[model samples]
Target: MEKEKIDAAQESSPGITRRGFLQTVGIGTLEIAVVGAVAPAVQAETRQRGNLVPLTLKVNGQRHELHVEPRWTLLYVLREKLELTGTKPGCDRGECGACTVLIDDRPRYSCLTLALEADGHEITTVEGLMHGEQLGPVQEAFVQEDGFQCGFCTPGQVVAAEGLLRHTANPDIGEIRTGMSGNLCRCGAYGHIFKAVQRAAILRK
Candidate 1:
C-alpha cells in the first residue's frame, strides 16, 4: 500500500510541477524578448556603420540642407521632409512617371533617384511650375482643356510638358507624344493631355 502511494505521488508530481512549468515559460518569454531586442539593435548597428552623407538639394529655386540615409530616395525626401506632396509616388521602382520631377530642366524619376544624387542640382516639381498665385501657362491650359480626370498624374505631366516647351516651342503631335510618353495616366486622358500641351505651347508663343 505504501509503495503504491509513493509511486502515485512521484508520477503525478514529476509530470508537471508548477515551478518547472513556470520556469520554462519564463525562459521562453525571456528568449523571445531577447531576440526581439537584439534584432533592432543589429539593424541599428548596421545602419550606423553605413555611410551617412550630407545632401543639399536645390528644389523649386530653394536650397534645402538635409541629413539623410544612404537609401533615402528623392521622392521620400521631397514629400516627407520638404513637405512637397505635389509629386505623386505611384511605383516606387520608377516604372511610373507619377513621381517625375525636373532635375537640371530635364525630367527624372524622383523615386528611383537618391537624394544625394540630386545634390548641387536644381530640381523643380509641380509646385514650382507656377510663379506666386499665377498658374503656369501649361497648368492653365490643362484646366481649360480638362486634361486630367483624377489629377494624380497631372503634376508629372505638367512638369514634363513644361520641360518639353522649354525645348520645343511648337512640338507636333508626334513630338508631344514622344516627350510625354514617360508619364502614365490611369484615367486614359491621353488625348486631352496632348491637346492641353499643344494649347500651352500656343499660349507660350
Candidate 2:
C-alpha cells in the first residue's frame, strides 16, 4: 500500500508540468495580484503633478469658487464646469469674438482668457443677460429688428452690444457699426444687426 501511494504521488508531483505546477502552487494568483496592484500605481502617476489653483469669479452678480488646471481657458471652465454654453466658440483666436463674454463689464474673448486670470473679476455671458422670464433690452431689440440671420454669432454680438451700451447708452449708426465690427456674421446680416444696436441704444435712452 505504501509503495502504491508513493508511485501515485510522483505521477501528480508539483514539478511534473512546469506551467500547470505554477498555477497549482498559486504563483498565477500572486502574478495577477502584483499586476493589479501596479495598475493602480500607474493610475496614481496620472493624477495631477501640479498644485490646484483656486479662483473666484463674479458672474452675473453671483460669486463662484473654482479649482482649475493651469492650462484650462476661461471658456472651457465656463462651458464645461459652470454649464454656461451661451457663449459660442468661432475662431478661438480672439479674432472672431464668438466666445465673447463680459469681463468687468467689458467685452472680452473668453477663449483666450485663462481661468486663473479671471480671478476676482466680474464676468457675464448671454445666459446672465436674462432676468428670470424677461429678456434684456438688447436681446429684445435683436428680435424686434431681425438683427440675426443664422444666429450663430448673435450671442456674442448681443453680449458685445451690452458692453458697448455700458459706456455709450446712446450710440449712433457709425458707432454701433464700429462697436459691433469685432463680432462677425457669416450670414451677411451686418446692416440689420447694426440697426438693432441703434434701436436698442435709443430704447435704453
Candidate 3:
C-alpha cells in the first residue's frame, strides 16, 4: 500500500522529461527564428519610404503647412490631417464625386489629386461654404428642397452645384444636368438636386 501511494503521488507531480525539454527548446527556437525572419522585413519596409515633404495648402481661406508622405492623396490629407471629413470617399476611383473639393473654383476629385499637387492651390471644402454660422445658398437650397436623401453624397453635390453656378448662373434643366454630371447621387435625388441648384441660382440673383 505504501509503494502504491508513492507511485500515485509521483504520477500526480509533473516532471519534465528529455523529450519535453527538447520540445520546449524546439518551440522557442522556432519562435526566435520567426521573429528574426520577420523583423528584418518589417524594418526594411519602415526604412523604405514616408519621408516628409513640405506641403503648403490654402484651405478654406487659411494657409496650412505640414510634412507629409509623397504618396498621400489630397483626400487623405484633407480628411485625416486637416480633419475636413465632410468629403466622403465613395468609389475612390474618381468615378464618384463624393470626394469633390473646389480647387481654384473648379470641382476636383481629391482622391485622385495628390497632396503635393494640391499644394499652393486654393482648396475649398464643404466646411468653407458657411458665412459666420449661416449655411451658403447651395447648402440652404439643398435643405429647403430636400435635395439629399442619404446625405452621404450631399457635400460633393453641393460643391459641384456651387461650381456650376459660378460658371453658369440661372442655368436651365438641361444645363443643370450637364453641369452636375460629374457628381453622382446614389439616393436617386437628382430631380430634387436640380431644383436645389435652381433655387440657389435664384437666391444668388
Candidate 4:
C-alpha cells in the first residue's frame, strides 16, 4: 500500500524527487542567509554616500568648494574628483612616496591623507608646479638631468625636491640625500635624481 502511494506521488510530481526538493530548499535558505548578511552592509554604504561633508580646498593657487565623503583620501579627490592625474598612486599606503603632495609647503603622502583633514589648507600637487605652459624649475631640472628612468616616481621626486629646496635653498649632497630619503626610486636613479635636485636648487636661485 505504502509503495503504491509513493509511486502515485512520484507520478503526480513528474521529475521531482526527494533529493531535488531538499536541494531546492537548501539553496533557497542559503540565498536568504546571504541576502540577510549583505543587506545591512549595502544600506550602510548608502548612508555613508548620503552623508557627504562639505569641503573647501585651496589647491594649486585656487580655492575649491565641494562635497566629499569623510573616508575619501586626498589622493582620490585629487585624481578622481578634481581631475589632477599627476600625483601617482603607488602603494596606496604611506610607505611609498609616489603620491606625495605639498601640504602648506611640506611633503605629505596624499594616499595617507584624508580629504577632510586637508580642508581649508593649501595643497599643491605636481600640476601646481607648472608656470602656465612651461614646466617648473624642478621639473625642468629632472628632465635635463635625466632624474628618472621609468618616470613613475618622477612627480613625487620632483615635489619632494621642491619641498627640500624651499627650506634649504642649497642642500649639500648629504642634505639632499637626507631630504629626499622619504621618496624611493625603483629604477635605481638616485645619482641622477640628486643631480636634478642640485640643478633645481641652482635654477630656483
Q: Candidate 2: minimum summed lDDT over ten consecutive residues — where?
A: 14-23
- Whole-model Cα lDDT of every candidate shown, in order: 0.90, 0.85, 0.89, 0.92
Screening candidate 2 with a backbone cut-off below 3 angstroms (N, C-alpha, C), the clashing residue pairs are: none
The prediction achieving the highest TM-score against the true structure is 4
Worst 10 residues of 1 by lDDT: 14-23
Tens digit per residue, CA lDDT, model 1, 5-80: 9999988776776656876898899778778799886787678667667788899999888778888899999987
Best by lDDT: 4
| Candidate order, TM-score descending | 4, 3, 1, 2
Rate residue 153 of model 3 by lDDT. Answer: 94
**For model 3, the run of ten residues with the poorest summed lDDT:** 41-50
* lDDT string, candidate 3, 1-205, tens digits: 9999999999998789765687689889977877879987677557645477888999999999888888889999998788788888989989989999999999999999999999778999999988879999899999999999999999999999988998888899999999899989988999999999999998767
Global local distance difference test of model 1: 0.90
Assess candidate 4 and give its TM-score to the true structure.
Answer: 0.79
Cα error, residue 175 of model 4, in Å, equals 0.8
> What shift in Å separates residue 30 of candidate 1 from its native position after superposition?
24
| C-alpha RMSD for every candidate | 18.7, 19.6, 16.8, 17.6
- State candidate 1's TM-score: 0.77
Q: Model 2 reaches what TM-score against the true structure?
A: 0.75
